[model samples]
Target: MRDALRRLSQGEAHPFDVSTGWDVVWEHARYPQKAVLGLAAGRLAERPLGPYDFKAGECRRILTRLGFAPVPKRSGGQESDDADDAAEADLRQRTGLGPTEKASLIRARRGQGIFRQNLERVEKRCRITGLRDRIHLRASHIKPWRSCSDHEKLDGNNGLLLSPHADHLLDRGFISFEDSGALLIADALDTRVLDQWRISQPRNASAFRAAQCKYLSYHREHIFLGRED
Candidate 1:
């Protein structure tokens, strides 16, 4: 756990997968305090907790510390932060925070902030495709945000600007990158099908930043499916 947390905090490679990590951690943490700590550490979900589900003020405190001001929710529900605080305090009293827990929270919070700032820096557009449609773009973490505690999640160097489709491809390892910034088309990618998707033009290989390339190295080694031309 310490090793995982350390990697997450530094934006280094980690083994955790985001989509399932949160649910798994939430279910496994016996203590509410530990669970809340996990959530705050970016171990629960890639995005912020819901506003209606959490008091604006409390959420603001956490987000503010991480450099993200909580936004008002359009819907309604009991505030999660209030409930979380109550539950966490009880659990914390029952079992004080361990060293691992404290480190994880610190890392998670910092990482999340870095991610938000990167999104703003790129103006939330796919650097390669140049697609600027907000709904179709994603703040993609090169090293998935959820895998790290807090600091790793927010590190701008750990992310990439991509369209939803490109994000999906990259996220799933169907596509990846070389250190030189060349797109590593998956071997299993059907050329006929790819042509229909309109992604054939070879990119200039200069759009990716050095930090972004570091994360891509992980994807290339661990995820990219190299099957075809």
Candidate 2:
């Protein structure tokens, strides 16, 4: 493997057909894996690094593009920190918030400040686990705060108190709730995770008020990935 990459990078001849793109008609409407490969098929998916055939070319290409070809100075240099810097800069322009105000507001978005206090008053425990401890729970927005208006961002009715694991599932669209409060599991989610996490996928533990249901409706319609059963 090492020799092949070295030879390839040095423009030396190699005996590896690692640059063939196979047309993989899989992964579907949910994940969109069509037009996947091929240097020049009936249709080519020009994805930057796929020229090296599907067998091994893609892997080699990714290793180099990710800047993992190996550096003399930094043995394992990390990826850039620019993502957060860019996101924060964008946030400042959108919200017109100075550094101090934006800092606390960002904290509130991650479950702190008045938003969390209001959520605590309405939701006493993690919905999925029934865990009453606040320390182990996170204040999760039903309609994500990132896409919300300021009014919705802070609305207690727009949030839920969820355990960290449950928050992850919901945030990533692995699960959601119907307006009637029934659990809606995503087709892509591994059912084994429910057992491992000890999640029961409860139904109607407590009724959501009309206002809360309003936001949950958006969750089911848009955020819920798709049905499993």
Candidate 3:
């Protein structure tokens, strides 16, 4: 997969989001190592563990083939759920390539060109608040790059241009949008952060289209943190 990503960087591939590159591989390995990698990948525990089992020795071999470091016996010890969580958290912090990001990576590997093409069409401004600082902006996923297909990534209808602060919250399921393009804050956010960003103000008179609203719904459902009053 890394080889494919390198090839992609050489201009032979589509424009893929950096975060999405890991998702594709995780989905591939979800089956055999569901318990081990599943916890590592941060899937809900409600999901049943797959019947498949491999001892630490065997898991080490599989991890080698997949280009990952072998799981240490004490280091999660192959499907030990408690330790598995620890290892998973460590991997996530180091790589920022959680399950969601893994899915994004896979999509990126498949369609590098198309993703870039679409991002170009989306103007470099926050579609929500119309903040236009380039250094502070990000090309956000509407359907999310990981779950998105090549076509979806390229679809102008499936994205929002956002500033980095807003993008960080949006990416982490912290913020959402109203049907009318108003910024909605998560309850978890300190009131100070909200005031700092001026999230209380409604969007200016930019006349947002329904397409933006459509994507906002996904953000609200999947990414938005905290409950509404």
Q: What is the C-alpha local distance difference test score of each model?
A: 0.49, 0.57, 0.48
Provide the RMSD of all predictions against the true structure, rounded to 1 decimal. Answer: 17.9, 12.2, 16.8
| TM-scores of all candidate predictions against the true structure | 0.47, 0.59, 0.45
Specify the highest-TM-score model's number.
2
lDDT of 3: 0.48
- Estimate, for each residue in 1-229, the C-alpha lDDT of model 1 and write its tens digit: 3333334345543223221111112222211112233345544566543223433223334543554322222111133224334544543455566856654443433333345565557445665687867556666666654344345555666777677677766766567777776777754455675576678646645556666676766555444543323
lDDT of 2 by residue, 22-93 (tens): 112222211011112222221233433332243222332344354432111111112112433454466777
Tell me how far candidate 2 lies from the true structure as C-alpha RMSD in angstroms.
12.2
lDDT of 3 at 117: 43
Model 3: CA > 4 A from native: 1-117, 120-124, 133-136, 202-207
| Each model's backbone clash number | 18, 9, 17
- Candidates 1 and 2, the one with greater lDDT: 2
Looking at model 3, residue 39 earns an lDDT score of 37
Name the weakest run of 10 consecutive residues (lDDT summed) in model 3: 15-24
Q: Is candidate 2 or candidate 3 better by lDDT?
A: 2
Give me the overall lDDT of model 2: 0.57
